[model samples]
Target: MKRALLGADDLFPTGGEAPPWPGRLVELDGSRLLVRDTPATAPGAEPALYVHGLGGSSTNWTDLAGLLAGRLEGQAIDLPGFGRSEPARRYTIAAFADRVIRWIEHSGRGPVHLFGNSLGGAISVRVAGLRPDLVRTLTLVSPALPFLDPRRSSQSRALPLLAIPRGDRLATRLLTRVTPEQMADQIIDSCFADPRRVSEMRRLEAVEEIRIRYELAHYIPAYLSSLRGLVSCFLRAYLPGAGSLWRIASRITAPTLVIGGRQDQLVDIRVAPQAARVIPDSRLLILDGVGHVAQMEVPRVVARAAVAMLDEVSRPDAERPPRPSRAVRVGVAAAKPGSAQVAPA
Candidate 1:
């Protein structure tokens, strides 16, 4: 057998050591959230927070956080009900946004640079719009804005809350008996391009996730109720994101970066222009051949883009509210309004 670069024995450095950083629990609106802080690894490091999307835990940002910590004090939180955090009483976008806001306040890092991906991106956008004072700048990746192209398939992307089997009784029954592997497989597949490529270590991690979900299954009814409320309140109507994104985006006062991938199956790149147009100070960047997972697909590019957005405003000579993001390439004509074509971004 070949020597693995990162062998099991090298899993973590051990000198009977304290973790380089410690994770703490914060109370946000009655919900306990898992938060970890990476102190200034450099002479002077700015503060930043990484928010994960629905069905994702803070682990999603672990690799990126490590890289970012080199330049800034890094923080990432497991939103209520995801990761190590307990589920929130209500799991709506607003609810999640409120949780994030509270976490920021709890961290005592005022006006921190906040980066979010997918659903996290959407919530970050909303929070920045309503509470710009708390946010120094915003970075969004393949944000899950409501681009309801009715023609596309929803085979892979399933919001665990929304994916709860319909009807309370059936869902309760299934939740009580379902295996963690079953839940983890569906959850992992939804985020990755190919489940076969999910890597062995991640597979092991999924085992723990499954165990957690199983333990929490007793709250299936509550999750279902929250799921319904979220879909009804935010996902419906002529408005988007429970119909708040456009309004929120239009009012965003902080400098912003809107990024997406050309091949994002869930969120079309076409949405980037509208995001640019709405966020008074936002710039758009569209990466090529990437899926919805831009951070995972191209972390360096996304991080560089985020740093640029921050420096765009942070630099003394830099101006405010940069010209709308120039990276948006109009998507191909597939889901043209009223046309039956399935648009490909």
Candidate 2:
């Protein structure tokens, strides 16, 4: 396989606080969001919107967004309660999806390529199902969908705490006692396949980021609410017919790409193919050594796959080849959204 070609911009930031990358705040009718916009180097490139995972900000997409800048005009959003965005008055998966849809609709950038990771991935799926006309294609990386073993996930472990009376406050107080650097280290251990791979500079940056977020009075509430929303979504996804994510995935008309990390401790990698099976026009990619945040860990590879998927879907039906069945497509390595090859476990 050919290595993915990448520029310096496709790399993670090394310096602290603000990096050299360009970003701005986008204000909608009811809310404001921080967006990292990367304009295409050439004219008339397709527009793409990226969503981050639970507890993550738009910064999660910084590397991947930059990598895809040449092929797509991309915007990485910090969902409400994460990053710089304020907490939503009512936090729910539907509410979050609605806000994203509103932003795209107001910006008149409908039918854009939609990419999401973790919670954002689930939100992107919701958007694709609700407003197919607004989504050109869908790409999900470690989407926070329901998994068989909830105990394997950190989010699941925290669910019990939320059930307690005044739980959110108690959790906040406990979190405050922990320093940002310690929290950053814990995150690295949980999210990465190899924690030592993170550089000292990057660690410092993460520490600073956590420090700022920890200082915010709304931070804990936002995190707690988002957690509840995701848990609620997972419960809803298990319902029979119509209401399930399976139903939503089947309804998506846009071509789709699903990415998973083999060593993902949060969302099980085994579920990747199951996710791809529901999307009529979709393929799955599982990275051997990677964990939860594939786009962050392997930005160039994910970007290359994304570009290829987009190109394949862009072709007219008469010109395009017959798509492979979901089972076959799930089996193939680096499978095209429409190809049929058995994926290796």
Candidate 3:
């Protein structure tokens, strides 16, 4: 049965109190994925897909998806072993990318406006590079691209732990000591520039989500294996070969918008410039006082920038603005209203 689209009154619940969008299990290539649909508010809205970062679920895109409902009918997927999805056979980036490809193919939603964060950004890069025909435009939020000398973030420190033997056990033991509420606080501290920006309701919601995920048997293995897989990809990303993400970025034909936070602890903001430089047709936006999750930190600003990109792309070849010859840096001040400043790189 087809579900009714959310009306304007239902779109943005008071105090962001709306629960997650409705989701259904989808069978694709012998795997089941949980997908949450945020129906478009307009009749001719374009199809879009949202891929969350590692350790995140489809709910990560809730705010951003709701904000973009006027322009995009979005589907956010739970990669196997995360959210309500079943466990996967493997947790490698390629495998995850393949699953995303399968879903797009299965749904016949090719050439979609693709949005990804952190690990999902890495996966989306692979998808866009490998199958350009399936993507219309790309937006990455602090994508976990290869970083040779990764910044000394908490996440970087955890990488070594994942490399150790029986790391999953060690991780399990460590996680056992931390309550879901504490875990949520740690995540907020690490992912946001200022922890105070997170509402108490959101914090409670995060704790509840973490508590539920803790009960799942596959959660630990999935997280540890995925981290290890990402580390492996990092090591392999710099080797002399056509497989490097840098090389892949050069091959992307889609007009891309790369957003990063100046205060990002996990993925160094320095890499954002390099990412924009490598992607043939891409622009960069660096938000001051924002952290790893720009989409979540400033959905309205992200939405404005995203809508701008969509508008530019939808214009005819003659009407479209000329592509900037060099990288353009846009700085949005603490997501304040009308505080975005654009300057030539």
Candidate 4:
């Protein structure tokens, strides 16, 4: 694979660019998924797939995908019922992973770079573990791996609602009170260390997306069920078993990059290092002052780290540098003092 050198100017889309990438519905195994395609700028660029977190869509990857477009022909999928995709009968992590695997197979893009955020991260872990042949590199941004501490983040506070009967309905009623604009603001506030980092245009786009999704009959159910499924997975992770995500992470064969935001409120930043430790060939990056969504919060930094990993993997084994004995922390200057720390080796 040829590597494309990205200058500082290439890290973001130019001003006055159009909206997010165009998307179309793709049918694979009788299921339709909405996929947004970002064409690569460099010749011979390899394929890459992006998966969004719960309550997010393919648009979540716009900035990061655009930043890496020179080295990767990126396709970001709106997992079942999230964006424009059709709902699935099951919303389990395994089900979501299967959809991703099937898409890679159907598109003949196997062994491609795989990217995921939050819920998508867990799904990507399963895909990289179960279908190692289909993933060349795995990049997880604040992956929602099973964390024992639910109180660490405000988002986890909603987990109990999933246990209550008709919690989806309750959620729907609560959400109905808030306008799409308010909802969008709330999401931005929760996901970003500084909500002001989000451009006004992006905020409008998010509100528009929420407005459209609110009309979808399956949207709320899909979101709630997926959350319940995630919580279930977390519980299962506690049991000593081979089926756990940690075990699966240990089995991943692809070169992995685990990116975490120091101020992430969804998935605890503390779990980031542990995730890197489990993967046999993995590098860890924790960005200071970043929140749950590092890709959106700091696309340039994320792209730099991602491109570096790609370059490293493209090199011949003899020429590649040795793996770090401990996580080599980077991008900390972008945050506050002592906000992030390297996990002990």
- TM-score versus the correct structure, for each prediction: 0.75, 0.86, 0.90, 0.91
Model 4 spans > 4 angstroms off: 1-18, 331-345
Residue pairs with backbone overlap in model 4: 111-134
Return the top candidate by lDDT. Answer: 4
lDDT tens per residue, model 2, 153-224? 765777777688877789888987888877887887778666655556566767787888877888778777
lDDT: which is higher, 2 or 3? Answer: 3
Model number with the top TM-score = 4
Model 4 residue-pair collision total: 1
Q: What local lDDT does model 2 show for residue 65?
A: 71
- Model 4, range 33-85, lDDT digits (tens) per residue? 89999999989999999999998888888878887888899999998989899
Count residue pairs with overlapping backbones in model 1.
7
Give candidate 4's TM-score.
0.91
lDDT of 4: 0.82
Over the full model, what C-alpha lDDT does candidate 2 score relative to the true structure?
0.73
For 1-345, candidate 3 gives per-residue lDDT tens digits of 010111233333234445678999988777689999999988999999999888988888878888788889999999899988999989999999999998999999887999999999999999999999999999998998988775635587677777689887888888899998888878888888766666666777788888998899888899888888888888888899888887888899998888888888888777777788888778777777788887777776678778777777788889965554554444545433211111000
Ranking by TM-score: 4, 3, 2, 1
**Model 2 error, position 209 (Å):** 1.2
Runs in model 3 lying further than 4 Å from the true structure: 1-17, 323-345
Model 2 Cα shift for residue 183 (angstroms)? 0.9
